[model samples]
Target: MTNIPEGKQMEAAIQNSFNEAKKLYEKHGIDVDDVLEQLSRIKISLHCWQGDDVRGFLNKGRELGGGIAVTGSYPGRASTPEQLRDDIDKAFELIPGRHKVNLHAIYADTDERVDLDELAPKHFENWVKWAKQKGYGLDFNPTCFSHEKASDGFTLSHPDAEVRQFWIDHCKASRKIGEYFGRELGQPCVTNIWIPDGYKDAPIDRLSPRVRLMEALDEIFSDPIDEAFNIDAVESKLFGIGSESYVVGSHEFYMGYALSRRKTVCFDSGHFHPTETISNKLSSWLLFGERLLLHVSRPVRWDSDHVVTMDDELLDIARELVRGKLLEKTHIGLDFFDGSINHVAAWVIGTRNTLKALLRAMLEPVDRLKEIELQGDYTSRLALVEEFKSYPFGAIWDYYCRNAGTPVREEWLAEVKRHEREVLCKRSQGEGSVV
Candidate 1:
């Protein structure tokens, strides 16, 4: 049984997540299965609301024989444990005993939140305890300080060292908070690190004090925290609010590559474009730069975090990553956020659809791939995806879609909404909202 969500434990980290994540890809055990599961859960939350509405979407997702793999108290430092649990409970009232949550948030803007210290630690601890009693895991996201702190969407980690240390203090307190929550709750927790400290001038010869920033995080987890906290390194793409020209790539790429091996490249699918590599076949532009080796997967539609489109080109690349065992070698997060669609329905469908597409991608051919390319023929592998006879990274989406009953739209939000309306409405008749 999983305990209920409360305070920052529920707000920052959910309960019993990795076990459910492991269970999701159990039958396949095929690396990318985990990728698909990760993407699907992200969709549920993206399509839902920042509060109770998302839990409602998750309530529907659990009934479908899957649960949300990535989610959170959302709306950043503003959420309280009580606010978060309100949403988690509504999810259960819909499906009863079927559901789970993993707390992972993007960058936090201080202007939007009250104060970091204002975070209710005890309430967060109780949520962790309750979630553990029920059987679940928790996760948190913290940002590394960089020069990008003065922006509109940047976290306060930037600014001045004193201000940065304030965040460092938050990290230390968060460790104690996480430790207390995990000790009392009986679940694993994770911390997601996405630093916005990159160069705007492109020629970044001088690597800033990023090492010190990450070291600050090390200080947080260095203590006796019982829960297994994962540090997911985010690969940022494009220039938007608080844009950073550089971000983490491969699992063992720079950053903590030399010291702690706890970091994992949480590739956001949107990097499939000029930012990261997704398709080796679509590497028409790859030869220009040797760095294409670390390209993250994405749809061909130019940097859009579409969340669902299954272009054969993008799937081929992500599949190769999985087939080469890259996907399994580290901790993975779906790495998606709301771009346009604010409604929960649009978000979940796109996420769920990507989940299905990723499953198809895992079946793509990769072993004889480089050799097959030299031969200048695509017939052999093409035959596999079209026929569904090949192993992971083979087989077309059409084949798998039939089995998952996934929707045919560009994103899965429509299908996610359909499920919520059809199934969740009846369940929520007498229950309160989870957020």
Candidate 2:
């Protein structure tokens, strides 16, 4: 029961623990070194909205509409593109492994008064340059919410043909931006389209809006961008703040549309009913589609988009990806905004939890477990599964973080606090506050 020492002694203890954990995993025929290497190669896209509370630079001072809201007055919300990028830089330093930045169309860095429909690759030149300099890949999305056009809780599915065309043009422009990101970065950029279009009350005609949505999406993807550069994905939601009754792009709608149109379907963890989980749908979707995009989020009561944690569902999702061998075909991205806490800490926590879950899944003796299941030894399978839960996963994770030169365990939180004192607290309330 010796107390753990400070400084140099702590490093030695962590290494000793990792050494013991490595041997324990080797007994189960798992290669700890290979698992760490695999985890290093996996990239999770960190959402930019988390740094700015979803208040994109293009629409400053506008109330967040279309069922979207960021609830918290936490200081140091990045107000400008430069500030947001700086904040993201701080977050990346605390988070291990190389990752990409996910951006909404409204985060366009140009100074010109360009609307969403007028967005071009040139507008995001600064983001591209920043990403290239940091050696990071990039992902793009067309923001269909928080605009006057979406005031009535609709965009692509809006009845007005003119309004529908406006969204269509914006999405088309967004694809071009995605293509530019991939071409410049030499990695395919997933351009995901998620529109908040549904009725708060039961609509007399639910079919029409979906029909319009289908048609609009058809027109939007009519000009096919090369898949090598830009990969298109359609995301669906169960319900949103304003649209609680009937969501036009329901799961079934997107599944039908994506499969029929040969496009990727995005499954948002927070977009499903409380009783349903995206972890169960990966195998089914991968059976038909070539690829899938995942918006890893935590939904408390509904689509709240809370920060992700290493909860049971997160572990199950990671297991499905590893067991089904769907990692290569799935694009992982964080999709939560918590203005209630330190924004950088939120990013570090969520991203690190996701990575830890993946590492845990990878360390499992899957072959042995599967063999037992096939041999009708259900008892042994269940026993092994439960027994492995108490394994020295933390030691391996600490080793990974230390090896990657990032903070180990809870060490990253101290860095977040120092940044808050030296940087975040200095921003004016007006600059940090969100509507």
Candidate 3:
């Protein structure tokens, strides 16, 4: 049998490679050590929905509603809160650096069915405890869809007073829970509200629905929670599966609201048209908004919510953040779910790819590039940009994984498969207890 490296031998190998990589980066005026430290501080919030196919444990695995769909039927989907947390833990172990947990209102751990309007902080007590214990910051979302009240595809902008009030109460309650999360975790929780309120066919009274939406949002934000504990954000979608014709909260609507209300705005990667990228829009939005929340997801052609990859758009987004030094002003979170593979593996892949993009961006010689650009040395700038493609960035990334004590490269996949064989498979076979 071939001798496999482990223990001290593996550690020594990683250190040796990292040292060489550090020297290589120094030639380009890049501080590899400082870059690694900065990368460590960039916490990507992992979405909770990926572990359960967006099938919130609400109403006992009821079919998803409100234009949401998970296309694959991969086995080992977490059926309970405990199972989902277990899967998340496995994925987190594989990813490097400290991270945050993003939760939806439907993920509340309750014994009985809790109406959306009646949701409270108590519903999310367990999540707070888990987040505190794991040292993960908590972010929250109000479940504006997948309920009876939202069957008509309108929430927050519903025509009926009673229907609109139901969602408003739910949103208000969700903010309270978000505040509680912030207090417990000692970090401000981003309470984001996204609603699927539109029609499959074009509506004649589009303006009226938007008017109602503005009024409803006014009510939702009427009670101000201390900014120290919680911050509010509004997300807009282009068009969902059911509402392909008209979406109430289009990007224009929320952008206007954020500008007027002076609240943080959210830009979901999959929410825009395929040809339109958020990379160029960052600086523009930053000029107007104080902070922006990013939902890093992949949309094949539409808002399919596929798992994120290290594609050009993803890299550009990370580059924009690094080049503009916008990391601190942006809250990065993953928002994709692919149930066709191991859920833990999906989480690990998406989160790791996100970190990879950020690290690559940080490795760029931005100061030098900008200097050349300012001097009008377009030829040298182009030459330098092309030269950077061949740098030893992988060695530095391997060093980061080693320093973070996470499995380096292909090694993490083995660990995930082992868990699937030993744990997840048993759960699917009915040999393990969940919840």
Query: How high a TM-score does candidate 2 get?
Result: 0.97
For candidate 2, the per-residue lDDT at 108 reads 90
Cα lDDT listed for each candidate: 0.39, 0.93, 0.90
1-435 per-residue lDDT for model 1 (tens digits): 567555435223222343343444344334544444443332121211233322221112222101112223222211334434443443323221122344422212123332343343543545565566655455454423322232322232243666566666655555555455445545434444444443444434433345554555565456555434323333434432223344322223332342344443344455434545544432332222112112222434444333454566545545654565444233333333332332344334434444544565554344455466678778965664465533322222322332344432333444434544554443445543232
lDDT of 2 at 273: 93
Tens digits of per-residue lDDT for model 3 on 1-435?
667667778788878988897887899899988999999998898999999889787677567889888877676888899898888888999999999999999898989668888989998888888888899999999998888889889989999999999999999998999899999899999999999989999889889999999999999999878888898999999999889999999999999999999899999999988788889999999988999999999989868888899999999999999999899999999999887788899999999999999998999899999999999999999998888777778888898998888998889999988888888888777544223
TM-score of each: 0.53, 0.97, 0.96
Best by TM-score: 2
Superposed model 3: Cα runs more than 4 Å off: 1-9, 430-435
Kindly list the per-residue Cα lDDT of model 2 for residues 139-205, writing each as its tens digit: 9999999888889988999999999999999999999999999999999999999999999999999
lDDT computed for candidate 1? 0.39
Query: What value does the lDDT take at residue 60 in candidate 3?
Result: 71
TM-score-sorted candidate list, best first: 2, 3, 1
Error of 2 at 210 (Å): 1.3
